[model samples]
Target: MMASVNEYYQQMEKTGIPKRFTHVLPPNEIEYKNWLVGQNGLPPVEEWRDRMYAETVKLLKTMQDGCKDQWDDDYWTAVIESKGVESPTNGHSLFSRCS
Candidate 1:
């Protein structure tokens, strides 16, 4: 299902994150921006706003591809907002986290 701007903002707030940036930009637009260029060593367009929303969708789909029930949409949203991809090195994320 296609997500909405409000859904993205809600996801961000659920993680105790400020929704100011994403409140301005939607999720698909935010992801497209990240896929484009960078700004000051950070995501150029709207900063880390709605990143949780986009990443949560990505993570859930990733898990659904193989792991399936290992994570539902809710679980993915939490993890995406929590620690992200959990790389062995940085132990955080591959793409979407601000800090």
Candidate 2:
């Protein structure tokens, strides 16, 4: 029997290819950028932006994990408003308090 879509995605995740290529640019584009850097000895502007975004996401995840106890709606709402970003959860709580 053929695998379901979820199973296909799970198999892909197991290979770790998706994680390795999480950048918005295609693999060919990234390769070309690397070649350009090799020629000029300077990184592409988009490379720096991608690195900054990845670092910011890592930092935010660490902060969220560290403050799991404070993962209430009020905290998320305040954070979303402070960043001038819309709430991804549509104003709903993203996590439930652990007993």
Candidate 3:
């Protein structure tokens, strides 16, 4: 029989691999998490995938929120000016230089 999720999480933590590091380690850890959360009769591969996706979304949202207030127009203008590069004109956008 498979171990319960709590048991599996405890085992991983005791082994010095936090559950979050499953994103970077071998597939076995992720498989184990999936296996633990699955129904007794069938595996919940979709659920595991959704969980990972949700983690990524959460991380992105956190990063975005952290930077949201730190990057206003004046900030970009100062950054460009400091680098001796001309800022974009009123009619053009920053991305225009990339084209």
Candidate 4:
């Protein structure tokens, strides 16, 4: 079963990955999120949430796989922060942009 969003958030916190890291999610993830949003109500909403959690977990794992030895908190932190957050020009919530 896929983990809950809270579980994923907790895992990210434990690993020193900030929630802000979502701001820098790769293009595929962004596309997935957009597609998921477009399919709203076609399936149960919980299913959407679960799929998103799975995708995010997959991305994180791929990132960790690229590390030389262990997960490098500093490197990930710098990469995430360097991407920074863009303001929502259309007045949508900042969180919605990540969604």
Most lDDT-accurate candidate: 2
The residue-level lDDT of candidate 3 at 2 comes to 44
Candidate lDDT values, in order = 0.53, 0.57, 0.56, 0.52
Error of 3 at 17 (Å): 5.7
Q: Give the per-residue lDDT digits (tens) of candidate 1, residues 1-99.
A: 347867866888897768666645553576667666664356555333355556656766676445433324444445445654342334433444323
Residue-level lDDT for 81 in candidate 4: 45
Model 2 bad stretches (over 4 Å): 1-70, 96-99
- On TM-score, the stronger of 3 and 4 is 3
lDDT of 4 by residue, 1-99 (tens): 246777867877997888988545554554666678678845333443455466556655877435333333344444444556332234332122221
Model 4 is weakest, by summed lDDT over 10 consecutive residues, at 90-99
- What's the lDDT for residue 14 in model 1? 91
Clashing pairs in 3: none
Error of 2 at 30 (Å): 22
Model 2 per-residue lDDT tens digits across residues 1-99: 346655755765886757445444543555766787879988664444455445445556778545444434675456556666666677556664456
Candidate 2 at residue 65, lDDT?
Answer: 42
**TM-score against native, each model:** 0.22, 0.26, 0.24, 0.24
Better of 1 and 4 by TM-score: 4
